[model samples]
Target: MRGWRNALMLSLLPVLVSGGLSAAGGPDYPITPVPFTKVRASDGFWAPRLETNRKVTLPANFQKCAETGRISNFAKAAGKMEGKHEGIFFNDSDVFKVAEGAAYTLALSPDPELDAYLDNLIALFAGAQEEDGYLYTARTIDPSRPAPGAGKERWADIKNAHELYNMGHMIEAAVAHHQATGKRQFLDVAVKCADLIDRVFGPGKKYAATGHPELELALAKLYRCTGEKRYLDLAKFFVDQRGNAEHRELYGLYYQDHEPFLQQREAVGHAVRAGYFYSGAADVAALTGNPAYIDAIDRIWENAVTRRMYLTGGIGSKREGEAFGADYELPNATAYCETCAAIANAFWNHRMFLLHGDAKYMDVFERTVYNGYLAGVSLEGDTFFYPNPLSSDGIFPFNHGEPKRSPWFGCSCCPTNVVRFFPSLPGCAYATEKDRIYVGLYFGGTAEVALDGGAVIIAQETRYPWDGAVRLTVTPEHAGEFELRLRIPGWAQGSPVPGDLYTYADPSPAVITL
Candidate 1:
């Protein structure tokens, strides 16, 4: 049994790392997640949604991209077809995000057809790359044409071009593809694009800032996958350069360039951008052992969850810029709780949980997943809500496009983000810290956790959210000692979150066992 478990652990490491659940040695994070492949989601709540994402959601998204010209935009850029760019400058990111979702789905349910479709898509990306290794379909389609906010030349408008943002999603999709399928066709393209970014932006380079903060976290994941020091350095540079007055006078707090990264204490600017920035900073802190980054992110998290967050675990109260307003400014009817922002909140909080192993972070994580984030997509899995308002008037019309969920949007980041995120839910259930195994989320799954002593199989059965009764059975390779900690969610303890902002009227105790 020990040898079999050891072999299983070795085989699952790549899948785990690819799913962003790798427990690779890092600074002071108390627990690291078990891989997605190692955990089987049998719970009533998540299993059906996971299946919907794979069968109904992902396939429908691919068809929508084709009909909406997102996939064709890449072909147009690669000379396989002839047409003007279809949507906004950031439309290319929607394709990459969908591809990422496909990769994660393939990890859970292997499909040859989906894998082949991804390869064809990656081929288009490879063909769309410029001679200099740059890959933005909107710009690469015609270098002489002016982008919406950028000039004709490359890297002209770092403020709104979204070049780095597109690259970030591209790198993320490629890494997931490589990890899930063991294919380097997409990964090679990402590496080339990343190398180009590295060469373009650094000390004494053309730019000293990021238009959006997604690339930082993507580059960090790339570094983790390839063990490339340059990728990590590039991520750090992007995080460090924020709020340095480089672009602050022009963008101000709207772009979160008000001050230095380490000097800022509160979550500001666009909610999605601020959340991605905080998540990336946490990644940098974990990789580099930098206390400043960790401290800054901690303060920002507190500000967000305490002063600015809604009871539904939603943020970004203002509708003007789709941004965060002053503290305690939550308005349910007009709440601009963008789905992307809610998903970003989950991303940041998940990193916080990994960094500190605190149940409070998971409390928020669970809240957003069930309420804010889940509200973005419909039960059928095709229509989407870009802005999830707490209280929607029958006639007031609060969403960006329509009053209710639509099949897609012109800016389809949220829908595609949901596609990529929901399938990875099982990976968040279990984590390991040395000899101790932490069970943060209970969703009726079996987790194969690798520990210092040997491999251990943790089997969990529960009816959660609907009910709090849970049972666990642990089988170690041999009779060895290890600690297993079960987190008690705030809702179960009368508080909605960790703080005094929100509370439940009727609280229930959580039942657990060893």
Candidate 2:
């Protein structure tokens, strides 16, 4: 077995060393950088066009708002006059604010109803933000709160408090807002909130890493967008803090902080939390070039892919703690495949694949994208299932007793989360190396990459996922021969594979010698 493993790795080494795969019958194409183009939903993928599926766009707001009957759920949850649960729900407020703002921006021409509704929602979000840059409706953020157990002890409920989660959402909203337009109104607010959190947590901060997970990934993205070294350093700090032995007990044993994330040797804790933490850690590995962190990621990934992961690429143990159990302990009906967890897993897998150029990561991504992801929202993209239980029978129960969908959920993270992730699908398909561009996924639409000494865009016009065949038309900006690497999906491992201009059966995961 050891020799076989070594031989297998040795055989696959050339493919890794080479750019990846190749285009058609030709010389090994040199990869030239091209301006990455946006994608739109076409063929079998959710989207195939870029810019069209943005979060702040009009269509998404309409879909989410209409699905939920209105964005009034936040106000109700927030309590009109500071009733309770104010700051704890920072995550939802951030999401709602972005949804509303994007809707307002996107509805000018075609979606009048969405336009008006989003305006009202935006106003609500703005009002909710404190002058100190704090924008939480959870009671924990309330200064006038009663002592623990006297009434709603918002501060004491830190375990359930999603302060960092909300901060992460704000960061995401800001990025989306900036992407949609050149304005930085909300982006500024998000930065303020992040700065406040930075001062309180990490190295010299008062608090520690969040048990809920979220802010780390958001912080990393924010750092990337703004080029602020502080943000990047802070994100790295949080990733390192997770699952540390001393810190784990300090936070609480409930979420499996009893051991370190790397030392634990298995995925655990809240499904969404574990996914978010892992995703953030992966980001840390990518940004810092930390081989140790990446090694931990690989170990955890092996367990997940080989044993713990669900067929849908969903990871978790059960509904009890919403945590992961022993390997292969996946119980379909009792599975707590939270929608957000699935989304987070998808996000993490994409990042890993991009960082390492590993086909196994994409294998996980494809499973989650197609199965657990789709189950989150209804076919219409409205309504959601907070818990994506594998098997739904009379005993397990669905919406009430069957697998049903709801426009809005009481806790409600899943509904909005589904909307946010699905719309951002195009950004995850392909990546670039020194001068080589790699086709990691088989989705429709074009990929514009900037690499080598010039730019090259691979325009893909084909129905994919539904069918294995993909039509890739290469257009070089500089009009020169460049190498474009294609991934021979691990699934197409059988003999006499769909060998064509775009694909070929390379059992050893061969590098394309175009």
Candidate 3:
């Protein structure tokens, strides 16, 4: 068995090395993710849901995007179809999220038909892009139809246009496509769009920040993927200019622009926007070693997790603006724990874990993944919940049509986010900190971890979140000293988290590892 494992590890080394597990300029953290393709989940809790996402959820979403005029809007913008913009200005992002989800699914399970479909969609995007690489279908399709509550001129309404947000998703989807397929067809388009954005919004140009805080993270990802310093600079610029009015007019506290990011410590404003901004700041800190970004993110994270979080790992207590309430203001029945907010929280927590390699962050990530985030989608993968309240009254109507999971929503960001997130989960299982590999989550899978010595295959088997007995078999190609660190979840040690916000009424029996 040992010889066979060694052979298997040797055979997979080339593939793992070529997959680009480490980020450009090396990750600032000690840990880095093992690529998704190298870790294959077995028959376990997440396997079925991952399968359903690939077979049922994504295809249905693609069809829905086609039927709902999202695809045709692109065609119309390209002059291939004649129709007005069908949905909101940000509707273009939904399509990109679906594409990203499909790319993640393809990384695990390749399908020729799905690949062909994505190729066709990329062609549509290519057609829709303007001469200088701008690609907002709502504005490109008909410049006469102004964005809701905004002007017709480009960049006129930075607070509501969502143009930057749309491009952010597009860049993310393009990078995912490139990573999954090793094809640059879509990546080239994203590069052009990003270049145009860089040219338009900088020191001497029309200095501006996105109303929605997603482009910073996207630019960070693009920079990491392409090793381009300008993208990283742009990302840092966005973070630095958050509260500076010279960049753009402040949209008030509701938009998280009341104070500079480094000065603000509480998690405020729209829940999703706040989470994305923090996550982007975390990324910038990782890349640039900016002490201000790191300090702000740590303080903000502590505030959110300790004072503003629910027992179910949910956030955003108020329904009025879908925003976070004051400290200890968590309401159970009327809690507005938007699904996207929970997802964003998970994203931020994961970045925190990457930055610090702390078990507390993984505990939060695991808790949110198993609870609030999973609650966003139905078991059958067809319906979704937009706001997942901790306790429901069975009468208080929530946003997105119904209190229960619904087939779709007028604003379908949550569902598409669910689609994009669930399939990329395997990448979070393990991280390599030089020669030492850390096991973060215990899913039954095989991870090919790249280390300074060589490739190590860690085969994990367990019934986690149900049973706590995990057996990890480590096989290295050549015998070289390396450490395997296993995270002991806070729950198993008789605490909910490393904070005073919540605690178990009684401690359960501690996990006994023989």
| Leading candidate by lDDT | 3
Off by over 4 Å in 3: 1-22, 147-150, 507-511
lDDT of 2 at 357: 61
Model 3, residue 390: distance off in Å is 0.8
Clashes of 2: 38
User: Model 2 over residues 136-225: C-alpha lDDT tens digits?
Assistant: 555323547532222354234445566566667767767665555455666676787777776666665544566577778788778767
In candidate 1 the C-alpha lDDT for residue 213 amounts to 81
Models ranked on lDDT = 3, 1, 2
Worst 10 residues of 3 by lDDT: 1-10
lDDT tens readout by residue for model 1, 1-514: 0000121232232111111233243433445778887888887888888888888889988898899989998898899998788788888899999999999999988998988999999999999988788999888777777446544678777778898999999999999999999999999999999999999888778545677889999998898888788888899998888877553344568777788889888889899999898898898888877778878888888989999998878889999888999988998889999999999999999888888777788888889889999999888899898888889766666666578888888788999999999877778877776665667787887889988778999888888878888778878997766666677666665677877777656655434332
Task: At residue 298, give the lDDT of candidate 1.
Answer: 87
Off by over 4 Å in 2: 1-37, 44-124, 140-142, 146-157, 245-248, 252-256, 394-396, 399-402, 494-514
Give lDDT per model, in order.
Answer: 0.82, 0.59, 0.84
For residues 232-343, what per-residue lDDT tens digits would candidate 3 score against the true structure? 8899888888888875677777778888888988999899999898888888888877667888999999999999998778888998899999999998888989899999
Clashes of each: 1, 38, 0
